[model samples]
Each structure stands twice: as structure tokens, then as C-alpha cells.
Target: MASVTYDRTSCVYPGAERPAVDELDLQVEDGEFLVLVGPSGCGKSTSLRMLAGLEDVTEGRILIGDRDVTGVPPKDRDIAMVFQNYALYPHMTVADNMGFALKIAGLNKSEISSRVHEAATLLDLEPYLDRKPKALSGGQRQRVAMGRAIVRQPQVFCMDEPLSNLDAKLRVQTRTQIAQLQRRLGVTTVYVTHDQVEAMTMGDRVCVLKDGLLMQVGKPRELYDRPSNVFVAGFIGSPAMNLFTLPVVDGGVAFGDVVHPVARDVLGRAGNSSVVLGVRPEDLELAEHGPAVEVDVVEELGADAYVYGRTKLGDGEHQITARVDGRRPPGKGEVLHVAPRAGHVHLFDVGTGERLGG
Candidate 1:
């Protein structure tokens, strides 16, 4: 319903030396689902709080559609937020809790009832309208919280880790439901979570942040394929991208006795500077003859198996990790040859952590 914009917005916690969020600029399109993702203490939550008017903006402006709402009170901003904890009125019935805001805003009884029923039906909670929060399951309680926001039909919807309390199976189920609901309602939504998988699966666009600074913003596949830096590369992938700080010698890099060929274009940028090589576990496959990897453990995960091991490269260092595919995985203490898939390697400048070659 509305496009949200943060124009150089920033926030500093009282008495803190550094700002919690620094000059953060972002744009969320109308009816777009934008996700903010980062590790703990990465300021993702602070940025969301600022947008919700729960935190003071020390600089810049936040705009909803074309209106500057930096100085506006939260209640007047036409935005509804669903918190991680189900902040429901324990004493009120489900229907009353959903319609309480409308009642407070002086909507007529008929209108309130209609809106409540509409939201309840959409969330499949019509059967439990008279039930209290104490009687509902955790997932049902979360739905009630969502029902409260849906009835308002606000310009923007903000969710702060709204599914964190649910069990893993319930979380996955609710995730699909929420995504479908957002698309059906076509409401502009901003969601904040630390889970990369959640951000990747649910967002129309994802903003990756660290230390209060925006790192990269893009569609899920784009970030996965072409992360701007080492942090983004490692953080966005499951099992994380394996990063090796290796020396570039001649036109190739030495991984023990095996001197894998590097693209001339990639090597030209090295120029005696230390380079970082990043390879996803999926990218490195078992080779007939390649760099030797010292196997540590093998895990059989039904559909796939992970070969955990250390590399016999350079000083014969040991690092623990899992290799996919159990059928042909190397046994413990066995040395297996590994090679990166063509065009699947990621190279970065060690000093800057900037991507050099795809």
C-alpha cells in the first residue's frame, strides 16, 4: 500500500559512543516485502525500531509513501507492528483483542465486528473467537497477534522476528502462511530477523547489515551468487562459504602439491597481494586428482551426506567441515582430492574483503 524510505536515517543509543544505526538509507517498494537480516548485535532490530517510531532518529527522515514521518507519533503513522512475543490482552477474548483498536478509535460497532470477522476468517481463527489467549496454542496465539494487525489495514506492516517462539516444524508452516498472506493482502511489509534462510525465502528484497552499516541489498539469488564482500559471502550461505587466505604465486595458487589453475583475469588482480578464495561446499566436488583433503568425519543425512575434513594444503592445516553426498564420501583419515566447480569460485582481496572475481 505504501513505499517506505529511510533517507540517511540513524540512531544512537543514549550514552553509547557509536551509533546503533548509522546513516542507513533504504527504499521498500509499494506492496514489497523487505527483510533486514544480520547477526546478533548487528543493529537490524534497532533499525526496525526506528522505523516503527519506538527509537529516536538522530538523523535523516523516514517516509511512508510521500509523507515524512520522522517526527510523527507512532499511533499517527498508519503502521501496524507484530512483535516476537505475542503481545495480546490476556483478559480479552480473541475477537475482542482483535477489535480493541478499532473500538478505541471510535469505529462503529458494526464496522468493528465486520473487520474482526474478516481478519479472523483470513487467519482461520473464526472458530476460536471466544477463546482466551491462555487457551490458544503458541502458533494460534501468534495468529491472533497477526489478526490484530490485519484488521487495521495499515499502510505498512512491520514484523520483528514474529515466528521465533514457534517450534521448528510450526515455524516452517507459519512461514509459508505468512508469505502467502502478505502477497494476498498486498501490504508493504518490513520484517527483521537474524535467520538468513528466513530472509532468503520470504523477502522480495533483503538488506544485509553489520555493525550498523548496510552491506548489501538485493534479491535473494543475486546476494547468494554475487555477494559484495567476504562477510556477505560467508553469512548468506548455509554451512557458510569456505574462505581461505592463501598466497598467490605466479599465475596460480598452491594447495599443497596441487597447483590449481586460476583464471588469468583473477590472477592479474593479485599482483603479489594476498587473496582470499571462497568456495561453497556444494561448489567443491570430489576429484579424481586434486588437492588432498584429510577426512575427519562423514555424516549421512539421507538425501545428502557431508564429508567433514581438514586440508593438507601448505602447512597441513586442519579445519572441520561437512561435504555433501554420503554414497562416495571419504572415510576418516583418508585423503581425497577436491576441485572447485568451474565459474563457481569466488575470489576476494584479503585486506579489503572485496570481491575480485566471480
Candidate 2:
């Protein structure tokens, strides 16, 4: 296994005014599973392609285990890539497809057969060795693609949205399997996906990018608990954090009649009349008396429910969401009082959108 590094690497398409991937300086330790995650057109895919040698690095360099590989050919980079579409040959049997790379590399028939059988056994595809791609299920076909990579034993693995084609249930199951498989193989991997949930669940360290710039890179819980800015604060969670630019009043920010207290330093950083307050849906609780919100819709998910509502705050109507007990959700058009749990609120500077000390 090998560590990978992008030292101020950038990719700018010809004639484009701005770079697709800005100066990205990231390091992945040996045997680490690093995930690049962001929204569409966020340059996550371009970053992955640059590492795989599919795209040119317009500036800086890429290193694989201390070797400068910015200009290296894809085949010479000693990396295996798994594409989203499976990319299995339709006419070849599972065994043949898995061993095709070895065959092209001049491995003898006997050696290729041995390696193919070994990978098939590990992937539980022994029974489907002779079956063609058309005969296998989506999950099984994905396993075949993985087997193709495993037999090569490359120093680095690059997977680009490898689970996008599967159904939801299969995607979840396969993600678990892939995570377990990566740990077992211990190969340095770089995975790209637009799904934050996938990045949170599978990556050893997750990197968030926006408009080709690296926003934050940390353990899943770190990014969730302490986002660096308003963009990240609003992007990482499932329900997303509810943010309001409320007027500062009495050493706190006001949400209707409710005043959520802030640290003195945090208040000092807000040099304006208002500060942006953030509260996750799960961090909000139904209160006896707080801001009154008109319930618009209730989404029940068995274990929990999400209450979507609208409330008048600071002379304008704003939408809010709160998580409550699924079995006892409030009905539509009903008004309920909700407040942020103590010590669970996030404060940001209104002018810069950066997180304030708390």
C-alpha cells in the first residue's frame, strides 16, 4: 500500500476562466480510505480523475508514495479504478472478465486461473464464475468489478461513485461490504461521491469540497459537530441545519420571543446588529413556551418524525424543521413552541459567515 498526496494540485479545462479543481493540498495515509464528497459541479470527480491520471494537473504535483506522478501514464501509476457503470465486458464470463487484466499483463493461463479463482472465492462469486455479465444481478456484477481490481493488487484504488447504479437497499448493503473489504485488503483508496451519508459512513476521513476548493476535511463526527463556515454548517447533515440571521438582543440572538444565549466572545465577534444562528433539527425540542411555529407537514419515519413549519421571526416568515417523536407528531396547521436545546446552538458572524467562537 502507498500514501497519496496532492500538493497544491489544480485542473483547469482549456479556455475556462476558472480552474475546475483549485489548489488542493490533501494527504492520504497508507491504507487510508479517503472520500471526496460534495454536490454536483463541485469538482470532486475532477479531483479523483486527476489522481487517476485521467485529467491533466495544470499546476502543482501529485505524489504516490513519494514518487512525483503528475505526468505519469494511468497504467504506470500502479492504481486500479472502479467505475460507476461496472464496466464489465458483456460477452466475457465472470472469470474471464476478472482475469482479463492479468492476461494482458502477460500472466500465464495457469497463474491467471489461480488468481481468478481466489478473488471469486473471496467475493462469493465462485458459483457465478462461468456466468456472463447479463446473467448476474447488479450486486453480483459489482462484485465482479471489485474482483477485477483486487486481483491486480495495485498500490492505490480509485472508485468513482461505485454504488450509484444499485437500488437503495443494495447500495446500503454494498457500501458496508465495500468498507469491510477495504479494511481487509488495506489498500489506499480515494472514493468520490456526491452523497454525504455515504462519505460519512464509509470514509476513514471525509473531505468536503465546494466550487473546486477544499472546504473541510475531518472525521465524520468532527465535521458534523463543528463546521467551519455557514456553507459547511448547512450542508453536512441529513435534515440540514436551520440557520437564521436574527437580531442580537441582550447578549443573545432572538428567535421571536426566545433568546438563545451565546458566549461573550461569540457575541463580540458579531460586530453587527445581527448574527446567524444555526440549530439542527435533532437538537431542537418541543417547549412549553418559546417561538410559536405553524406546522406545515409532518414526515414520519417510524423511529422519528420531522416537523416542517413556518414562523414569523424578525418581520419576515422563515421556515423551520424540528425532529420529534414519530408516534406523537403534531398535526398540520397546529402551532407548537420549539426551542434549541441548551449548549447545542451554533453561532456565525453575519458578515463573514464564519463560525464564531463558543
Candidate 3:
């Protein structure tokens, strides 16, 4: 296994004023599973492609372990990749497909056979070793692709949206399998996906990217609790974070009829400027005495209910969402009092979108 490092790396397509990735510096520890996650056009995939040598590196260096591989060909980099599609050879049997690379590298027949069998056993594909790709299910074909990579035992594994082709249920199942397999094999891995849920559940640490910039890289909960900017806050959460601009005056922030005290520094930054307040759906609660909201819709999600509404905070209208027990929820057109959990609130500069609480 190897640690992968990108040092001030950048990639630019011809004629584009902005690079697809800019001064991207990150490190993946040996045997660690790191995930790159973000929205479409956020450069998550571009960063991965750059690491995989599929895209040209316009600046900086990439290192695997202690070796600088900035100019190395992808095939010589000792890395195995799993693509979004299964990318299996339809004409070859499962075993042959898995062992083809070994055969090309001139490994003896016995050694190639042994490695293929070991990988097949690990992936539970031994039973279908003779089956061709046409006969296998999508999940099974994906396993074959993984098995092919496993047999190589490369220094790093780069997977680009490997679960995207599977059905939702299969995707979840395969997700668990892949995580467990990586742990067992102890191979350093870099996984790329747009799904936050997958990144949170599978990665040891998630690297969030946007607009060619690195937003934040941390354990899942850290990013959720302390996002560096408004983009990270809004993009990382389910139902997303509710954000609204509230002017700072009298050393407090006003939301509807409620006024929340702020720190002196936070208040100073606001100085007549508007600050954005962010509250997660789960962080907002139904309160008898809080900001009044007119519920427009309610979604029951078995264990919880999410109320979507609009509230008047000072002279501006802000959309609000609150998560409450699903057993009972306020109806449409009903006025409800919603309180954001104290100390769980996120404050950001309205103009720059940077977090304001130091």
C-alpha cells in the first residue's frame, strides 16, 4: 500500500481561463479510504482523473509513497482502477477477464491462476468463473471488475463512481461489500462520487470540492458541524442547510419575532452588513415560543417529519425546514413556532460566504 499525495496540482483544459482543478493539495494515508465528493461540475472527477493520469497535469507534482510520479505513464504507476461502468471483457470468461493483465505481464500460468482464484474467492465469484460477462448480473460484473483490480494488489486503487451503474438497493449492498473488502485487503483507495451519503458512510475522510477549489476535507461529522464556507454547509447535508440573510443590529440577529444574541466579534463583522444564518433540518425543533412559520408542506419519512415553510424575519422572507417526530406534524397553512437548536447554528458572511464564528 502507498500514500498518495498531490502537491499544488492543477489541470487546465485548452482555451479555458480557469483550471478544472486549482492548486489542489491533498494526501491519502497508506491503507486509508479517501472519498472525493461534490456536485456536478465541481471538479471532483477532474481531480480524480488527474491523479489517475487520464488528464494532463498542468502544474505541480503527484507522489506515490516516496516516488514522484508526475511524469510517469499511468500503466507504470502501479495503480488499478475501477470505472463507472463495469468495463469487463464480454468475449472472455470471468476468470480470463480477471487474469488477462497477469497473462500480458508474462506471469507464469500457475501464478496467474492462483491469483485469479484467490480474488474470485474473495469476491464470491469462484462459482461463476467460467461464465462470460453477458451472463452475469450488473452487480456480478462489477465484482468481476473489482476482482480484476484485487488480483493486481497495486499500490493504490482509484475508483470513479463505481457504484453509479447499480440499482439503489444493489448500490448500498455493494457499498458495504467494497468497504469491507478494502479493509480486509488493506489497500490505499481513492473513491470518487457525487453522493454525500456514500462519502459519509464509506470514507475514512471525505474531500469536498467545488468550482475547482477544495472546500473542506475531514471526517464526515466535522464537515457537518464546522463547514468552512456556506457552499460546504449547503452541499454536505441532506435536505441541505437552510440559509437566510439576517442583518446584524443591536448586537443580536433577528429571525422573525426572535432575536438571538451573537458574539462581539461576529456582531462586529456584521456591522450593518447582512450575515447568513444556517440551520440544518435536524437542528430545528418545534417550539411553543420561537420564530413563527407558516407551514406550506410536510413530508413524513417514517421516523421523522420535515416541515417546509416560509417565515418573515424582519422585513425579509426566508424559507425554513424543521425535522420533527413523524407521529404528529402541523398541517399546511398552520402557523408553528420553530426554534433552531442553540450553539448548533452556523453563521456566515453574506458577501463572501465564509464562516463567521472563527
User: Candidate 2 vs candidate 3: which has greater lDDT?
Assistant: 2
Error of 2 at 312 (Å): 1.6
Query: lDDT by residue for model 1 over 135-212, one digit each (tens)?
Result: 999999999999999999999999999999999999999999999999999999999999999999999999999999
The C-alpha local distance difference test score for the whole of candidate 1 amounts to 0.88
lDDT agreement of model 3 with the native = 0.89
Tens-place lDDT digits, model 2, residues 80-108: 98989989999999999999889999999
- The parts of candidate 1 lying over 4 Å away from their true place are 268-272, 314-322
Deviation in Å, model 2, residue 113 alpha carbon: 1.6
**lDDT (0 to 1) per candidate:** 0.88, 0.92, 0.89
Local lDDT at 332 for model 3? 91
Worst 10 residues of 3 by lDDT: 265-274
TM-scores, all models, native as reference: 0.95, 0.96, 0.96
Which residue pairs come into collision in candidate 2? none
